[model samples]
Target: MKYKPHEQGFSILEMLVAMSITIGLTGTLFYFFKQSQDSFVVESARTEMNQNFRAALDLMARDIQAAGAGIPMFLGPIASKDGGGTNSNPSLNPPDAILLLYGNSSFSPVTVKAQSSYPAPTSTSSTIYTDIPTTAFAPGNYILYTPAQSLMQASNLTDYAEFSLFNLPSTSAIGTVSSGGTVIGNQLTPSTFSINPSDDNTYWNHTMSFPSSTSLRVVPLDEVIEYAIDTTSSELRRNRNKAGWVTVARNIFNMQVRYQIETYDDSTATYTASWIDQVNQAATNNRALIRSVEVTLFGRTQMSGSGDRQGQRAIAQTLEVAPRNLNLPGFAPNR
Candidate 1:
């Protein structure tokens, strides 16, 4: 072969070295490109998580502040379940759930025209005949109906009217509404009215009789909100007005709730404030003592990997909300 630079092909050693340099350069470029793509995806997922988490918390905070608005003090405003998730067996230490009740003050209490209490609170005799028309009551709306027998509670001194919550009488429960908007003479059928035992207080298991119109009160509650985590899908759920649960945010791994209350310390001869995990079986009137609510939500991105690349990394945010309508003992906010 010619040795002239223009005519001669490169020697074997030189050709080998040049090929090695080109391969090394190409491999390095590809590696950097792959790294850049992975970083972008991870960051994008985290940003999405932040948005979802913020939206979920905002909705919950608003409801927490409105917990007791337009509700009677005697009616417990807030209730919580320690383990709200599907595996939420209390012993399992699952996520938590919270329920809040409130009403629209505009909805005045309807006096009962007549009521029945037979076959127990389980049957149709549980129907409540109100002086007002059934027009105001709708599906999912609640009425606090007082029976003649269970009207007094030692815990409640002001109003001797003890009431049980029912979820019907919307005219759909039985006969249709009349021209006057009232279902005169007609009553709801059996299985129409379902009692919510956990409303303000527990209802007596025994059947009780209805009281006279003058003695009975029909209080209306417009709001019943519950927040929980759907463990199976790892999402946050919200249920409103006895409606079915709906997803609030995705990839929300866990939720926790705590009740903040003021308790009187007999030993210290003073008042103390604390946050408790469970409110159902507390020594004192925990529900009534609740001055505020504390929520902890855990959110994570939607990627899956190990170590630094793990999409399971969770970001936790905490919020404390106090309802203006909640009554506090011993201490009052300045007007």
Candidate 2:
């Protein structure tokens, strides 16, 4: 027989020791991996929250800067509706509401082209003849009409009427393509417009009647914009032209608004500007004196925090904006 070498193998104690060491290493690695994943999740949530907050803030600020632009001072370009959560904490309740009014540059006074009321006031037919160009106005659009007489007499907006344009007679005022059915051209003709009727009680029709070629003040309905935070959804909403509430930002808790009024004292040659809130008595008396607006926003984090990070779960910020178009002394002709 050949000389046999003794078989050298691991002893049971040695094997047990090696296996224990391997298991401990694996357990440590797994624990480290779990911790890293948790950290990543938390950080990702925070990053997303910050991004949303920045975007929402930028949009609101931009709009606030542009508020009251091309709008009349008598129209109350900026109006605030207070959401009464102050008896309790505002953060525990809903946010305040604000309305900003601006103007459409394209809006103008249009003369009724029809000699007689083409569609009778009582007639449900959606039709009106105007001196607007055929291509200037499009079907499926909306027109906010304010009767000239009503606007002169009324203190409120009860006389305003908003109508959706129906099928308007198309004209090839511009060169039309051979393939395309009709490329309407622009012409200041007596264009016929059959607009969608709203209700029975529009003051323009119910109250006053206009002569042929009478001028009607046509306005863009969306000039009035409303911003509010919904308590149920915890989302910031924007509603324009009563088109319905559109969610603009999420994870928002509360919003408070205040106006800074500037009262110039000629005696002292100084201006005293005081910030007034809805609850203050001076708000109503000095609404027209508003020179700037102060907004407070409270935001909530997506992730819940523990002991060390508890305060990070909620954040509050204040933004003060001075609109360029308001509280200024200027004469705007034919605005």
Candidate 3:
């Protein structure tokens, strides 16, 4: 069919304009789509990190609460001395004589103290029965004597006992000098003998004494529980005593631990929460005790490009754990 030259298909300029508009629209849509994808990736990564952090914290809290369970009492004995020492008595080479009592099912009101026979070792293999004054030894000194051995073992005695300063009571009873007895340079020694005159009469020559006792009573609580990150491989690993430290989440960047301690006032009947280290110091000085713990975790997205990614996502959380022995006198829970 005949057609005019003006009625031809699209001219070069028209085609160019059309292509330009199509490209512009496509570019705009592509930009928006890319942004949406990035946002989704970031959010997903953040969510995963949060879940991982929670799982880790929960695992830690559970284990910490279970610490010293079924374990020997002396294994978790409170520190009585500031220096290093084994938990065995010097004379008996046996385990320390600290007694542990769980006051409640929650294991929170626990008590640890030295047994009456703990500080002395008998000479004979048979059980020795002697009412030795608690004043014979220095207060807070780690005493490890066996009931089978006499407290006054001869100098010839070898392997007489094993003793560590850890987990001994902060205070001890000592013989008083007012009743013709003397405390010789913080050492309680018998100077004279006294008799009970009445049925209700007990020896009036004993006094409570306090000496340097530095020992750890509770195990320290871990903040992270478990967390790991590999920037080179873009992998994250975390575990909380589950199935042999299995990985719970990936692509983590960092993990941190913060602690909270509750300080109690006997006069006011009030409690205050403070940081872990601060509480630790106070507890060590017999000022306050640790009551709770908190944990925080941070993570990042996996790398998809060779160069560094300008965008990053963070996940954080906090957990609170109440420690055992919170209300006990002179006892501080470690977290």
Give candidate 2's error at residue 173 in angstroms. 29
Enumerate residue pairs that collide in model 1. 84-95
lDDT of 3 by residue, 118-204 (tens): 222221121212233322333232221211122121111221111111222233333332223633222122121111111110211
Which candidate's TM-score is highest? Answer: 1
**Top lDDT prediction, candidate number:** 1
Looking at model 3, report the run of 10 residues with the lowest lDDT sum: 95-104
Error of 3 at 245 (Å): 7.2
Ranking of candidates on lDDT, top first: 1, 2, 3
The CA-based lDDT of model 2 is what?
0.52
Mind giving the per-residue lDDT tens digits that candidate 1 earns over 103-218?
65666555544334211233224655555443465555554533222222122222222234555545576443244764443333323233232442323222221222234545
As a TM-score, model 2 comes out at 0.55
Higher-scoring candidate on TM-score, 1 or 3: 1
The superposed Cα distance between candidate 1 and the true structure at residue 134, in angstroms, equals 15
TM-scores, each model vs. reference: 0.68, 0.55, 0.44
